[model samples]
Target: MKLFVNSLSFLLNVSVVALVVGGATGLAIIRDHQERLPSIEPLLDYRPSVRSLVEDSEGSPLLSLGKERRDLVSLDEIPEHLINAFIAAEDKNFWDHEGYDALAITRAAVRNFGAGGVKSGASTITQQLVKNVVLTTERSIERKIQEALLAFEIEKHLSKDEILERYLNEIYLGRGAYGVSRAAEIYFGKSLSDLTLSENAFLAGLPKAPTRYGLDIEQGKGRQSYVLSRMSLENMISEEEYAHALAAPLLISEGDNDTEQDQASHFVRSALTEVESIVEDAGDALAEGYVVRITQDSDLQGALEKSLREALIAYEYRQSAWKGPYKEDLPPVDSWTATPVLMDGDSYFVSINGEPLPLSKDSVKFANRGEFTLAPGMRVLVEKVGDKAKIRQVPDVQGAAVAMDPKTGRVLAMTGSFTQDGQFFNRAMDAHRQPGSLLKPFIYAQALEDGWSPTSPILDTGVAIQSNGQNEVWRPRDHNFSKSGFVTLRSGLEYSRNSVTLRLAEAIGEEKIGNLFEGMGIHKKAEPGLSIALGSQESTLLDLVSAYAALANDGVPKRPVMVESVSSKDGTVVYEPEDFIDEREPFFDEVTLAQIRSMMAGVTEYGTAWRAFEGAGYTVHGKTGTTNQARDTWFIGFTQNLVVGAFVGFDAPEPLGRGESGGSTAAPIVRAFFDQIDETYRISDYQLPDGAKIIEIDPDTGIPFDGGFKEIIRED
Candidate 1:
């Protein structure tokens, strides 16, 4: 009996020794595996490809562009209930476990085996974080081992809160939202701090399947109820709170997924193009979370848009005889849907869907004297404003306007078209059209440099130039087709006399004028012909405005600055406006600029643009441009503080109408814009340069006269 007892003790002792040895060997293997895993230190500094933001000069976000939208939040900012909700839904034993949950994994294994598929994943928050950060979704045992090993290593280096924070931010929530903060905005249109218990539960339920749960509220409700039940069962939430949350209705706010997309779209597009030109690999830069600051004034932009639309509508109404929609032309009361086709002045052209409706005589009346053509599939809308039916065009006639700061060359307001929807072309900088008489100012500036004062007289008689190859003779005549005998240069420009301008160009040499035009900022090579003097060179509104701004800045040209600066996510300025002031020697003498400016003032005071600003209460130096047949009309004007340019024309060049000259057409729009300016911005007159002296001069020969009449001349 004693020998058997001793043998049993020895066997038990041997069993204990073997168990200890095996357990130690297993622990060493795990430690070695953990050591072999990649370090999670890089994850501590991990940053996702956040959306790039475009801001206005005032620091208001104008737009954001990217595939993923994320706003990072610290763990402290996360509410305790929010964290508890996620813990209950994803991992109840998250704090207790190092990297994984053994019991949950065993239960999931059995369930998956029973179902012959992956019914559930028992990954802890840390394990999930490791998978998202470093591992793929592959279900192989090798991948699972790697994931487990990485999670253990991560837990050793990072705290529970750190793991939770990273996991919350790295997970994808639907609608291009990647983090809780962004998801909060996407789902509720509110910040994370503003989320209610029900909203919190809804978000907590999304990690399982964000798309399925995010899109359908019914599906989300089921998962949300499960999450709330789990929270209650885990004591994370009181039973009363759980009940209240479960009873709460799911109210989803409208997602602003595309809100930043189309607002100020034309300006945004232009800014993006400019940014791309400066930053090579702009896509990568955007992904790295760059911020672009542009010089767009939202208030001014809104006003500019409204003014352009109103001006076009008013012009169309004046030109057209159609008062309103005809009763006979109207569709049946119910069948006539108030579909908006095109905006004509105050009326909208109405039509029924899928119906063929001819434009009534009322609608065609605005059509430029037999120049209106309506294509098939044209749409219109009609609405009752008061007692009359008003018709409007869907995509109204297009136009562009640009306002800039002459000192800094900053574009304060710009629009590519009257409406941002239909056409995507940016007319402000991209549309290269004939400047018409807008080029005349540069020619006159050249004349000033050549010692010709504003009162220099030129013959306004018929001038003929033989075509180089054709037998046709080009005889330039005034708009009135009558000669004025002789007129001062200022008078010639104010009246836009074609004959006077052509003769002056002949005497000064067109090539010299062309060189001066290039020096002033007209980028295109000047057209070779006597007609070039009549403003026939192709230039963009931006270039033309900048050139005029040079004159406003006293002969120093400033490159138009659309983007003020660009910064990266780390707040490093990547690009800034530098060397934009053209220092290639002064193109025009200060006295010449001052003299021309004074002469341009005549255009607004007593010339073609007179009626437009008769009682405007302030003086503006400006020039009016009317192309041949009035295809393009322009008004480039400036005060001491601002420079604004407006253009009206058809996309396909055609005569606007019989009397739609720049003075009568585009000048009125400019006047309407200035009328809206606050009194503080209004400047009564430009400060004359020191070298210039005002003296009484004879209007006929531009020679000094002792009479009371006064003119500005350079003291050479």
Candidate 2:
């Protein structure tokens, strides 16, 4: 019996030894395979280049804000208080951890296993950084092993400071902001250096979930209070401190002069758009780190704003009742607004304004905030709403103003209303109304291009042009309901003879006429009809500005561009515009433009636009146009240095209280802008070429029967 038991024990021992050896062999094979495969250490220290679109200097995110999902800034650059707050709220021991906090992870794991489901992840900053930077947030044992390996690898290479910096910056802080600096600006209306402890705590609490903590502007104090409560619960601040901060008014910085003058919005908007393109080209990660420098002249912008405000006020009170040569109705104008633009002709640094009128929607909104009033000289409001503007209501006013450099077509200033607080409907770019006599210059220009001089005879006996398969009898007439049978072309244009314009349009041919306007940057489609010369077609302010600039540039047209260049934060060039040496197509011959310019100069000097020309010490040349019922008024003109256009009218196309001709309502604003300019630059005539000759002819008779005609210039 003893030998039998011993034999059983021996066999059991042998079986155990065999099983142990087999397990050892399998473990050795697994180890060898692991050695052959590349170690997971390389996966840990990942750094993605966060892309940022170019933005204006004011730091307003120019691109669609919520698109790019990064804000990588150095951790040390963030306020220490912010770091402390974040640590207290999230992982108390983010430092001194390899990849995971054992205590927290174990506790979470046990609870999750017992619950038979994956609960919340007990992720430290490093762990979260590993997941975000290296591996996507996915659930699997393989992925977990990969994450753990990567985190350990991260610990091997990057120092704690560099790792933490990457983690903090790459984390989403809500409101389309990626870093502490942007969050500080977006939330507190202050900088990172300026964050108070309370502000830091509020921002620190956001990394866990930005949307829940982000203060909605519409909710006002309620959202703020909720954020403060979260901070207190996280032990970032005492209850008393939380209550105090909640009660504290929003911390609006004193010197946020960035947008106080409306100086940077234009530049910032351009930068953001430019950066967006760069990012699209370079991919998001690389583009986010791009830093752009813009040619924004803030001082010039402020001056423009001030001058526009003063000019609008002066016009409202003084020239409110003025009339033009084409109108019988005089003013006691119901409402009026005007804009003026100043441009550096060489570089395209343009500044412009459309000062607010009392009845505008923007004014009403301002009145609600107690910033604007029904009368002039109202006090300004300077306050901040969280992540948005706390502006007064946009006024009911209908007007727009724009300014640009004639040489490059870069817009200097663009405003829809006189008041920055008023309606933002950029009349200059948005509205595409008929230009009335504004089309006469183009007609005369086309005639010149067709080998006819401004002195050519065009009998202004109302003629109906019927051609192009679409026209009925279209009898074009003069503004004053009178016709001169044999008026010289120069006299007819100076007097804005509409009958003469229609006659010239027929001579030039509608197809050729349409092509002329298109070449000059007019984008609106011209109907195949006689009224095409009477400015019956619609056009934007931008179109008119570019077209006029083409004329000012001796018929050489250049497409408008705002940004000059862009670069990465490391100073690597991302984008630089090819020299302004673009193709210059001839919209009209130099001599033709010269002749038309001379005729328009007459309109300013002794004809319709004299009001804008006479009072100003500098030489100004422009044409005035008034549509029927005074629905639209325009003044398009330029000096030797700048070309600016102004339009004024009601929003609903109502008759803008009688006598609101382009000269009376729009020209005066141009005068105001030029008067401001004469104080700065040397204003002179649009120099006529040497070969151009000025000939006197009869005003009433087309024949050179007597030199009783005005001095009409013919340029060859």
**Candidate number of the best lDDT:** 1
Question: Which 10-residue span in candidate 2 carries the lowest summed lDDT?
Answer: 346-355
lDDT, each prediction: 0.71, 0.57
Off by over 4 Å in 1: 1-49, 67-259, 262-264, 320-391, 467-472, 481-484, 698-707
In model 2, what lDDT does residue 447 have?
A: 78
- lDDT per residue (tens digit) for residues 280-300 in model 2: 222222224455544333443
What TM-score quantifies how close candidate 2 is to the native fold?
Answer: 0.55
Question: What are the models' TM-scores?
Answer: 0.60, 0.55
The lDDT, on a scale of 0 to 1, for candidate 2 is: 0.57
lDDT per residue for candidate 1 within 509-542, as digits (tens), equals: 8678777777777755776776767777678888
lDDT, residue 654, candidate 1: 82
Task: Find the candidate with the highest TM-score and give its number.
Answer: 1
